[model samples]
Target: MGIKSFLASRKNQNKITTHMPLKVSDYMSTKLITFKTDDKIETVIDSLIKYRISGGPVVNSKHELIGIISEGDCIKQLSDSRYHNLPMTNNTVEACMIKNVETIDGNMNIFDAANKFLESKRRRFPIVENGKLVGQISQKDILKAALALKGHDWK
Candidate 1:
């Protein structure tokens, strides 16, 4: 082989495969199931069961995320007498939702998102874009992404 051709082939063989940087937007579930602040606990519970989700984002009339509610929060009500009777129906979602919620930006790196979920022990997180609810990310989502990258499909 000619020297130039040999050098060209060697250069091609030395090329390295680079992984594209992962963005939260790329991995986050866009089919966001959300609840409103004024929604009833029973309504939230029904949606949770219907969607088979552990938690979801709470939004206002403007579609801005106000807080979040999870199955854990609903379970807490089962033990409280105030939430046991018919009068409890008057309570709103805002009363039961966790206002101090952890959020992740859609532009953040997936690794950073995984680290945050691990450090905070949060299972579900709302994805925000310009302070508005765009989607959601969960531990399951991250795990699915990781598995896909590893060439394994999660069962």
Candidate 2:
């Protein structure tokens, strides 16, 4: 049988679930470094560097996620400032954040989340529950889960 057909034939079998599929909550990082919409880009940059992260979720006054800010976003702001011959210090995260963000629920399967990572340009996904930020999932998290599934110690 062809590889595709063989895999397709086994799709309905429970062979893959020898162990339960990893859930987002199982692998997502709960200790997140988040930012506020009105926070200064400079401060956000410093925090991102301090936290050793590429980006973070941006929240509102009520701690509801409103956008996402990343090193790429920060770079865009700097590029624009240089282009316009203006100081980069005056900008806020809100000015450069990606307002329409894609979020995942904590209960989502790691396979589904992996598909999202493969299909999009985002390096991470913000985990939300009841419209509140709960955790963050990244490619690294998925890799860890995959390694664990294969009976390998990722840590």
Candidate 3:
């Protein structure tokens, strides 16, 4: 290959791997809104609605994440209540939360984490470090980070 072409090709390869090292901490939302496992589902719903969020992490008394509760999960209870005349107000978050959750390490690069998001049905992922919930990253966060890269390689 010509010297100029080889150098241009190498630069393009560097561009791909350069952003691969960008950490999730750089884009994750550290000011996370969360819920407690024992918190009443009604309260959970209220907080979610108030914050205009679809869901949040469910933590325990020691502030350790246990699960995630979302509006989609609540819909089942609401539907049961309407069909069977059962009360939904008495439920706890633990009863409706998704106990099996996928979490990401806070230090994971944005590119890798974005791939995880793309492969899963989840809209958001909890960022954990040392088994403690540190922050949250959503699809929007990845999009925002990607958009920030647009002007970087511009002429």
Candidate 4:
């Protein structure tokens, strides 16, 4: 009888756990540099520069996400102030924040989140649970998740 290949049989049995798609929560940033509506735009600018972040979520005292503020918004505020020759001192985050915020569910698949980013043209999306801001996910976070699972099947 021909010698059977033990390696071939082992290979058939070696395929282990079925790879599940990664979720947004698996790589979202929980400890975020969030801002509030009452926060000064100058303060927001300072936080953004200090943290090296382009934007952040605007929340309430109860941690409820109400808006999003970005670098572009701050620039617009600055430009408006310059155009009208007015000082941008008392400007609050609500003056420039995008109030109709779009949030993402934590249970969403990582790939799906990528698609949402593309569709919305947003850099980051905040995750809320029971109306409370829990975390935020970004394009970089999804990329990190992909790199972490580089060798594994993305199914």
Q: Pick the candidate with the highest lDDT.
A: 4
Q: Across residues 48-145, which tens digit of lDDT does each residue of candidate 1 receive?
A: 99999998888898889899988988777654736555456545678888998878888888888999998999898888878788989888888877
Over the stretch 40-151, how does candidate 3's per-residue lDDT look in tens digits?
Answer: 8788879888999999998877668899999988887788778988677658888899999889887888889889988997899998777788899999998988888665
- Candidate 4 global lDDT: 0.92
lDDT of model 3 at position 77:
72
Clashes of 3: 0
Candidate 4 segments exceeding 4 Å error: 1-12, 18-21
Task: Write the residue-wise lDDT of candidate 4 on 13-32 in tens digits.
Answer: 89687755589999999999
lDDT of 2 at 103: 91
- Compute the lDDT of residue 39 as modeled in candidate 1: 86
Model 2, residue 63: distance off in Å is 1.7
Instruction: Please identify which of the two predictions, 3 or 4, would achieve the higher TM-score against the true structure.
Output: 4
Off by over 4 Å in 1: 1-9, 12-21, 82-86, 152-155
Error of 4 at 30 (Å): 0.3
Better of 2 and 4 by TM-score: 4
What tens digits encode model 2's per-residue C-alpha lDDT throughout 89-146?
A: 6689888999999998889899999998999967999988887888999999999889
Give the better candidate number (1 or 4) by TM-score: 4
Query: Model 4 — TM-score against the truth?
Result: 0.86
Top TM-score model: 4
Q: Could you estimate the TM-score for every candidate?
A: 0.81, 0.81, 0.82, 0.86
Candidate 4 lDDT for residue 74? 93
Error (Å) of candidate 1 at residue 90 is 4.1
